[model samples]
Target: MSAGLLILFYLGLSLGPLILAWAQELDPRTPWDELATGLGFLALAIILVEFLLLGRFRLVTGRVGSDVVMRSHQLLARAALVLAVLHPFFYISPRTPAPAWDVTRQSVVDQSWHALWPGIVAWLLLGGLVAMALAKEVSGLRYQHWRLLHGLGAAVIAGFGVLHALRAGRYSADPALAAVWLALLALALGALAYVYLIAPLLRLRRPWRVREVRHEADRTWVLTLTPDFRGRLPYRAGQFAWLNVGKPVVSLDENPFSIASAPSAGPEIEFLIKEQGDSTCRTGQIAPGTRAWLEAPHGHLIIDKHPDAAGIALVAGGVGLAPLMGILRELHATGDQRPTALIYGNRHAGQIAYGPELERLAREHGTELVHVLSEPPPGWTGETGLITPDLLRRHFGPPDRHGWLYVLCGPPPMLTMVEDTLIDMGIPAHRILSEQFVYD
Candidate 1:
């Protein structure tokens, strides 16, 4: 089905009960039921479209135009929250006789209040979630901390929503509809359980024991791994795996780093991690014998799948050289002699990751290497001051904007500028590939 049809179908499922109520087929006696059922279905639709159709969880190969999916998910979630609130308040406000709350009221002294509490809690949590999502900035709140709270808050909201629905009976008058809602809820919960519990547990079971952790120059550590399980993890170079450093709390945290080593180099996988964050800061302290969890190679930048082109341009900034190293290694291993040029960008010569190695590889494979230093030493002989359009043209002979494939990996600002330059130079969006190493 077309996207338009899918959207219409989703909307119909969400508003079906309300439409029925408008037609007087849905009993007005169960106003509580009407509100709950409508909200529940709306929430389910949001969950289905995001997790199932949009592939939000499958961070590997999922490509649902980031802007479109993010905006839609946020909008749907906010609408669902509004419906969640209206469901209970509408049902309880003396508007409907033989109310769902009245039934609970007749049962016990404060049963009505108890039934009402879940909805209230859900609303409170949902309100916070929506605010956090929409807010431009939260004063003094760190992004990671806010993200963790957001996740926990979402869980609480979902739980309360489920509880509210179960307690309010009239809205889900049709047993089949109620069952469908419950099934969708269960599926969403299952997706969560699989991601946090089952998948991680499975990864834990099949650990990649630390075979080597060599501290390289420029505060970067080269980690080597040998799968404890018999065979090697079927992975492509330039892809990354989640590394579980072994402290009780740390073990639960998995950080993704590029597979710096070649795929042809056997089961012993390697990653070059630069110490730049809270996680990486302590990674160097990890002992030799600590067991590490590995989530296999995940990225769509594999050279073979991209495009068949004559010449390729690989751009790197600081530690962004890791993936390019993998790409070049793969090209060399296969004897694929496509004239390649690597524009290595860094603050200074000392900050460049894989500098010597890249130079050696270039000499061996006849690939061109151009080092661009942003903050060069007074006597520095390398090309200086950023990966500008002029530098790119000078070293690689004016970018073949329409034809040549440009693979970029760098800090967000640099990447943005580079992308803008490419677009201005008449390169189609599809022809240029980029992967942002956003930790979150």
Candidate 2:
């Protein structure tokens, strides 16, 4: 689906509950009480929608990049937390039993133990959930453990929140509003189940095996995976997949990596991984023929989406060259005639991946390759220092280059700086595509 349609669908789902409550047309409460109820309803709806934004659904993350989806999830969670926390304080209604005439409980807040206990529990748990997520690094929890905790905690909060709404909410007494809350709760929990259970079950049927693990640039390894089945995995050049090597289908040890090899490279998929984490650091040690699994084809960095562009500009920093390498290789393999250029930056010469192949592209495919190093070795003739605006102007400042599609994958600071520089140079924002290597 188009990005605009996806956003409209999201808005419809999030606002459906609030709109239903408003349509109930019950006796109106004071302004503060109405404000409290509105905030509470909105917060619960947003929290339910958070399940689909967890970066697991290909439909959601495929159009928008995974980094964008994940960043939205984090930001929206914080917003929901703020709304939920302030939901009760705005109430000016008395905390006492409802009067006989106040059938909709417009004169008093529901203070009975049965109605209030669930709210109290959910409120406290929601605070702790957001706190733990924000402080995950300092909490000293492993990524896998933290993921499990996060999923369970969210499930509990959803359960309690729904219960509180059905029991204590002024508008929730309407049968239609109660049904809407139940449906939303079911969908939220169903999304969780699909991610943790159903998806893994399907993955178990299409297992892969490690074909090779060869060392490349500094602290980097190029690992290849071959499917146990006959057919090859289909994917775009600049896309990525979740790699679960030497782990079970259900394990959370999988890490997302760009597919370094092109689709034309055959059944065996390749990944250029750096030794950064516990799973990645053991890349070289993984035995050939070890069992592996893949969650294929995620991300929106492919070239087919921008076919009308006159040219392509690829910018890479450190290990960020993986996906771009896939794009370059695909172009070369498919004999794509579009003009192409690469601006690769590294701290030292030893850090550049596929150096000889890149030179081959420069010679055979007419790709313009510019190497930028922060710390150049002796006799180095290339540009020095970071990828500055001056260097960008030297290559891409031409009026013709402004129409070319600019694709970037790099460190967060470098991506931000280069993106800003591109925009400042009058390149339209729609022509620039970038994905950051780090989401946290």
lDDT of 1 by residue, 344-438 (tens): 89887677776677778888987888888888988988798988977765655554535667888878788888888777777777767676676
For model 2, residues 1-440, the per-residue Cα lDDT tens digits are: 98899899889888888899889888789999999999999889999999989888888998888999999889988999999999999999899898898887989998889988888898999899999998988998988889899999999999999999999988898889899899989999999999878888898878999999999999999999999987878899999998899877888788899999999978889999999877789999999999999988888898888989999999999899999999999989998999999999999999999999999999999999999999999999998999998899989998999889999999999999999999999999888889887668
The TM-scores, one per candidate, come to 0.77, 0.98
TM-score of candidate 1 versus the correct structure, residues matched by position: 0.77
When summed lDDT is taken over every stretch of 10 residues in candidate 2, the lowest stretch is 431-440
The 0-to-1 C-alpha lDDT of every candidate, in the order given, reads 0.66, 0.91
**Alpha-carbon lDDT of model 1:** 0.66
Best by TM-score: 2
Top-lDDT structure, candidate number? 2
| lDDT (Cα) of model 2 | 0.91
Q: Which stretches of candidate 1 lie over 4 Å from their true place?
A: 1-44, 47-116, 130-150, 165-171, 247-251, 393-401
Supply candidate 1's per-residue lDDT for 4. Answer: 64
